[model samples]
Every structure is written in C-alpha cells, then in structure tokens.
Target: MSKSKNESNGGITAYSVKTKTKNVPMIDPVIDIKSGRYIATGKDSEGNKMAAILGKAKAEEHIKNGDAKKGTGWD
Candidate 1:
C-alpha cells in the first residue's frame, strides 16, 4: 500500500515506500541509465507541460507521454 501527506506548498506529492524486493524511497529521482530515473525541467506555468528536456530515448519518451510534472530539483 501507499501513503500520502500534505505539502507545505499546498501541493500533494505521492511517495510509496516499498519494502519488498527492495526498500525504495519514492521521493527523489534516481538518475541512472539502468535505473531509468528522470527529472522534470520544471513547469511551463503559462501552459500545462514542461519546456524542453535532455534524456535518453525512453526517458525523453516519459517527459512526452508519462505522468511527469514539476518537482524539487534532483532531490
């Protein structure tokens, strides 16, 4: 199961601490090619998407089609 807490900035960040095969803290993005981690290029305030991005093919695909949004940089 997952849990959620309120954010001070009035935004909601979802984190699921998995304790199965591995203990994963789902807060920061783990930027490794094998891990397939990614970071958002921040939001396009005027619009509803990011500006541009730099990543591998799959990661780039995520920025384009995944449920990616702005988050604290490289946390």
Candidate 2:
C-alpha cells in the first residue's frame, strides 16, 4: 500500500510500493522552499526529487507523467 500527507506549504508527500526485490522508496518528487519542483533519478541525500524552477503547467506535467507523486506523506 501507499500514502501521502500535506506539508506546511502547498506541497505534498507521497509513498508507493517498492520495486521487485528491494523495499526502497519510490522515485517521487518533493516541493521545497526554493528550487521549486523536480524529479528523482534515484540519488541524493534525502533521495527526494531534484528541485526545478518550473512553472505550474510544467510541474503538473511531471506529476502526470508519474515523475512526481501527489498527495501526503506516510505515517
């Protein structure tokens, strides 16, 4: 199963089933104070999506493409 939660700002958190063998977190993006929206190439300290200075339309496109998951954080 998966879940999500709302952040302080107008951003969201998401979690989904891991891959075939590993229980690793899925490649999902996260909205931040700066940098804006971005996607995950499966690397980084937080492993969160890379931050991008994209517009609303473009950001939505990422979400639609499943590059970014929408909703809340896990409990």
Candidate 3:
C-alpha cells in the first residue's frame, strides 16, 4: 500500500475516514473508475504509486453497495 508523505504518523487513513470505523481498510485508496478496484489514493512514502491488496474486496463491495457515497461528516 502507498502512503502520502504528508500523511500524519499515527493519524487516520483515508480508508478509515471514509468508512467511519465501519470495518474499513487502513490505507488511502483510489477507486479505478473502469475496473472498480481500490488503488492507492496518494503517493507512497517514497513518492511512488501503490495499490493495496488488503482493501480491494472491501472497497469494491462498498462501492457496489453505494456505501462509498455520502459523507460521515468527519470533516
């Protein structure tokens, strides 16, 4: 998985933020508009692109069920 350099240490990940602690992954993910896979949302710590094997199924399911929509109002 990739982590942005700006990602705060011990801070909440985009995945967790999106799911609002509802059985979500622990990384920032980008949904591929074509394949619907969960790829890394930002650059890795080393500034390279990344994808997480751990979050794919869950993210896909979330997207399919429209759980990816709406805000948790966390911001």
- Root-mean-square deviation of every model: 12.8, 11.9, 12.3
Of candidate 2, the 10-residue stretch with the lowest lDDT total is 1-10
Collision pairs in model 1: none
User: What TM-score against the true fold does each predicted structure earn?
Assistant: 0.24, 0.32, 0.27
Better of 1 and 3 by TM-score: 3
Candidate number that wins on TM-score, 2 or 3? 2
lDDT of 2 by residue, 1-75 (tens): 332232212333233223222223334454232334333333223544333333456446556655555433211
Q: List the residue pairs that clash in candidate 2.
A: 4-72, 4-73, 5-72, 5-73, 13-72
Per-residue lDDT of model 3, residues 1-75, tens digit only: 765432234222343333233222334334443244344343333344433332545544544554343222211
Score candidate 1 by TM-score against the native: 0.24
List, residue by residue over 2-68, the lDDT tens digit for candidate 1. Answer: 3323121222222222222122222322222333444333322222222222255534444344334
Clash count list over all predictions:
0, 5, 0
